[model samples]
Target: MRLRVHTLLFWPHLVAGLLAGLIIGVMSFTGLALAFEHPILERADRETQQVAPPSPGTPRLPVDELIARVRAARPEAQPSAVTEYPDPTRAVTVSTGRTGGVYVNPYTGEVWDWGASGWRAFFHLMEDWHRWLGAQGDNRPVGKAITGASNALFFFLAVTGLYLWWPRKWTWRTLRPSIWFRRGLKGKARDWNWHNVTGFWLLPVLIVLTATGMVISYKGVSDLVFRLAGETPPTAGGPPPGPPIHVPVPPPGSAPLPLEALFVQARKQLPAWENITLRLSGGGAPRGNAPQAGPRPGGNEGKAEARKEGLAPSTFAIRETGGWPLFAATQVFVDPYTAQVLRKDAFADLPAGNRTRRWLRFLHTGEALGLTGQFVAALGCLGGLFLVWTGFCLSWRRFFPAKPGLVSSGDASTSE
Candidate 1:
């Protein structure tokens, strides 16, 4: 009975580990690369980051002027938002869309075209690959299903691995080899020891990483989590309306609120705020709307109301203090014309489930603990890769023992 029970658990664990490892190995490798994505991209954009501060006594350019300048530079590429930095030396970013943006010196309006930089493009591609195996744009059904299911399986493997790594004897003698690397070890013993020890230390982190990944991958699980937390998922009924439409242009000669005024209002709400990025609805002809000049080539005058309803509003993201810098920022919506604050969704205000959900990115990437956290997460990925290799070695040797004399015992041990 004892032998039978052990076999039952062992075989399933081994089989699942092998299958999940193939997918997780790729995910882990990409994760290792993504761990330093922000810093890497910053370095890549060093030229833009090093912009000189405005000349002495030169005032920062007005937000409206900057918008006009950007529009003149790329008429087809509408201005969606501008990200201002606290550092005077750094220029504000003007995003046209997913693939285009420019860095303009707030003081002088000197534009640095980051719209088509190779490094930025490469990282964008890496992000897609990391999230969905480059699933051809974000959240495609095929890519999401593959990643989501595999991620859940990886979580299963981690849990079972912990059970298997537990020492049956429960003695210091038995525990030492499982917790620490052994020196002068050889063949299968070394592989087994490495796999066990690494798994022992990294199991907790692996659980966090894989579990959070599942929350991001599946809506049902996410909704359940929110329900458990006594809150409804943000988009309970339908997908959150496509990114807030840009606010329509205010009347001419009205002189909309200054960007500085809005920044001051945001800072007052959170005194420790460091950075904020504001995205304006584009003024140029909104894409997907009927042709402005006349009816379509088909000569059909589209419904005017539907076209009006399609415009997105302006929104700004604030980097709140005491939260994950990359992922915990608060989202603020504003009336583009009046610059009136419409709503604020800070970290603390989020539902318990949503709050937990927000932490998923930081936990997965190990950014919650800053550089050290990132390093540890990267190490976990490396450890995961090793686990796959050593796992395959151990599994193969056990399942396919060498034929009696076809392979010498000594050679077989060495190969294992």
Candidate 2:
């Protein structure tokens, strides 16, 4: 039977599906390949001032000693935030510049930065391609429009693909997908059956994943979710102003009350936390109750003193003035003096509009799941790649076939 035009919206959905499928398929596979690599540093990290525990009778390595080591190694660099993960296997991470200057093996002092790993470079480029389609600048309006339209396409594709896969009558012959046989070099029917059946099973996952992903890269549609949930915040775009007068915290090495003590004291007070990551307070300043920035580009970053923390700041994105430590799913802040956690939140804390934002973000990175999640996402990507290829081939044949075909595209006006 020939494809319909107006009723199914098949042709438009087919085209958009191809593009979205290609993007997600290639990107997801590369990400799956990249995950096997470790982010551990190889050189002496300039940002983190991690040191070994003090001698038996000694207190934890003094912040002074760590700071001294960092300054000694890289005098020109400005060490901003200091932090420590309670996990012993990993050294304290620091937030220095645009990139991370991780210092590991506090006792031995080893570090590694992005050398000539073409993989890292490719990974970064892939992210941009996925996010901006290689376009740069503050033209977020344009980016959103493109991604939003693409998302709508993804939604339609998922739905229609599901419908096409559903069989009207199930028989033993049709029950098993066609590809399981040894088609050594046989007909394309088995290939078609394999593709269609696999797609049917994977339909649910890809639909949600693709739709949520689109929601993130586009703001126009996101606003609808925001409006429905009453989650839009007017000041979301601008950074909060810094305090009129900055209150200076003592230098890194000078404080008698170590931040470890402070972190432990604080965690004791807060509940429902898996654990706390003690970061160096770099930028050399205190945390304030002001609005802050850091999700995407082109937001305000008011001037303030660098933040201070347990170790010299070098490893992570430290918020010196306002904002809070980076929460995997949500954001929160802490009061350094009293071990008090301020603005504590998780996924539940997101605005109703933004509530869906968290899942979208996780789906974007595939960190939203465990080992199984990674594998499942990878399978989805593979399925998408197959769907794109077969669909493209089938579509071309259906449209401008090399030879006479069983199917004919309804009309020239069917496609955009």
Candidate 3:
């Protein structure tokens, strides 16, 4: 019975690996490349864009001055957000739009036209391949579907591969070869040994990676996770709108609060902030509907009316030291003119389901656990590459076995 069951599982496993091996290999290689993307990009940025202060304790240029300098250098650019690091050596990044930005030397107010590094472009390409097999335009959905299905298959392979790799007779003699690499192996022996050892040791990490990937790729799977956690799934489109809060109105013809004031408020809000990004309201468009001076909210109706009158608030996303889960940021929304914090959304305020979603999202890339997790994930990807190579070798030898007294260069390489 054991032999029969093993045979049944073995055939399906072999066939699935054969069918999905190429796509799996692509994802694994791309994932490996992307594992250290954050650190790699940081190093590249420092090497190219790091600046020095003229003297010790020299205060950096004001945020408003930085934006003005960037706009003066590129008249066509609309500055939308400015990210300030606590480290004075780091340049301020004034973003114009999504993924468009320039690094500004805060000391000299010099706007550096820093284009994406080759490593950044390479990682972007790797991400495209990882997510959608490099599909573009209308075909992205199709590519996404293919990769998602293959990811699900990979999860199955991990599970079954674990079972198949387990020794039926538990002993050093039975298990030693499967658990470790052996010398003097050739052809089928070598391939089989590699396939089993790699699969067994890396199975847990691969399972985690593939399972999180499935959650990201399929809404149904994500919703199921939320359901399992007894939390309602977040609706499509965006997070459900938060309850209305009273936004203080500024008198007509009053200039908006200076960026300095907003930064002060943000610092007061999160004293331990390591970095804070101030995103301008309306993409820094002209504020045409400046609110007339009015009393504070007297009731819920007044608050709703304030929100309806285009008193949109700019936001500060603050990343502080020792933040749990590593990826969560605190969002502070302040009225543009009043500098009154309308709302603050901390990580603790997130619903359990959304928190779970965030964790799964980062865990897919191993960022949730920091650099160590990323390294482990990269190792898993490396093991996956070996598994695919060995599995293909084994399958090739099975279908096209060596004939009597037949030897070729290709055969010699495979046998080696």
Candidate 4:
């Protein structure tokens, strides 16, 4: 009976491992590469990361003047918005139109960088490879479907692999080969032992990674998970209802508060915040409120309803430095004219589902636990690659047994 069960699992595990290993290995390696993207980009652009703090007596350029300078610098480009870093030495990054953006010194309006290029651009490419196999552009559904299916298979493999790694007797002696590296082993024996040891040690992390990858790839599964946690997953229907704060249009000929002043005031409210993305009121939507753009099913209807309810200014997206950027953001809706903060939604104060949704990115990237987590995840990816390579070798050798005495005694016993 025990042998029959092992035989039953062996074929499927072997086949799935062979079939999905290549794609999973690619994903794992790309993910490992992406794990250090932030620090890499920081290092690549270290000089641009911060500028010399201006002389205390000198005032930073006014918001309109900065905008004028960007327009003057790139007259062909339409400046959309600017990201003000809390650090005075950091140049504000400006977004222009759809694809191109430039970083400009607030003190002197000097351009630092532009467009989808550099370490950031390389990571975006790696992200495409990681999630979609780089077969489709911009996360096409077909690519997602393929990656999702492979992730499911990988999850299945992890579970079955765990069962196979379980020693029948559960004795220290019996389990040592699975749990530790064996010296003096050669050929398939060494490969088999290493695969088992690495897989056993990294099993939990691989499981979590594949599980989260599935959640990200499948909408139904994501919804089911949210429901299981007693929360509704965000849908593409409409903007969520926010506090009932009425937005008043500024009087005719009255100027709105300066962008710099609003940020200065917001800084007062959120002292620890590292970055602020302010969308001028009465625009299409606040940057952070809606995750995606381009008309939704009821997008127009939702806008009409928001207009009816006077929730016009959905406000600015401010991010602090405590956790991953996605999870550490707080939406602050200010009275665009007064610079008065009307309402705030901090990450810690979010509902369970929203928080979980925010946390998904960090969990997927293994950055939720910081540098240590990143290192562990990178190692798991490395182990996953090794498992795929070794599993393939072991399977190949098993199908075509080696010459007499070439195979190890322990592996020979398992064959019987």
TM-score of each model, paired residue for residue:
0.80, 0.65, 0.86, 0.85
1 against 3, candidate with superior lDDT: 3
Candidate 4 lDDT, 1-416, residue by residue in tens: 88788889989999998888888888888888898876676677767657788998777886656767777887777665566876788877777744456788888877655432666778878888887788765656677777788889989999999888878897888889889998877777778888899999999988988888887787777776667668665474222343455556667776556667776776776777767765432231232232121111111112333356344543556667664443466666666567777667666655565556546646777777777778888887888888888988888887887989666665643312
lDDT of 3: 0.76
Candidate 4: give the clashing pairs. Answer: none
Q: Ten consecutive residues with minimal summed lDDT in candidate 2? A: 311-320
Q: Write the per-residue lDDT of candidate 1 for residues 1-416, one digit (tens) a residue.
A: 64566667777878887777777787888788778776676777877655775678878887667777887777777776666766778787887776577888787777768732776777677677667778774556677677777788878878977777766688998789789988777556777888898898998888988887887787887777767777655554221222233355566665445666665565566666656666554563212221211111111112222237543333456675555544566666555446566556665654556556556646878877777888888888888888888888888777886677664333433321
* Number of the top lDDT candidate: 3
Clashing pairs in 1: 81-279, 245-312, 245-313, 246-281, 246-312, 246-313
Off by over 4 Å in 4: 75-81, 96-100, 114-118, 237-245, 249-257, 279-305, 309-311, 321-326, 405-416
- Estimate candidate 1's alpha-carbon lDDT, on a 0 to 1 scale: 0.66
CA deviation > 4 Å runs, candidate 3: 54-59, 237-255, 285-309, 404-416
What lDDT does candidate 3 reach at residue 110?
A: 88
In order, candidate lDDTs are 0.66, 0.47, 0.76, 0.69
Per-candidate alpha-carbon RMSD to the true structure: 7.6, 8.3, 6.2, 4.4
Cα lDDT tens digits, model 3, 1-416, are 87788888989998999999999999999999999998887777774467875597677777888888888998988776677877777788876765567899989998876554687779989999998999998999999998998889999999988878878889998888788987777767778888888988888899999999999899888887778877766565223234565566677887777787788888888888878776554445322121111100111112344557656565667888897758777777667687777777776775666667778878888888899999999999999899999989988988898786654433353321
Report residue 221 deviation for candidate 2 (angstroms). 3.5
**Deviation in Å, model 2, residue 322 alpha carbon:** 29
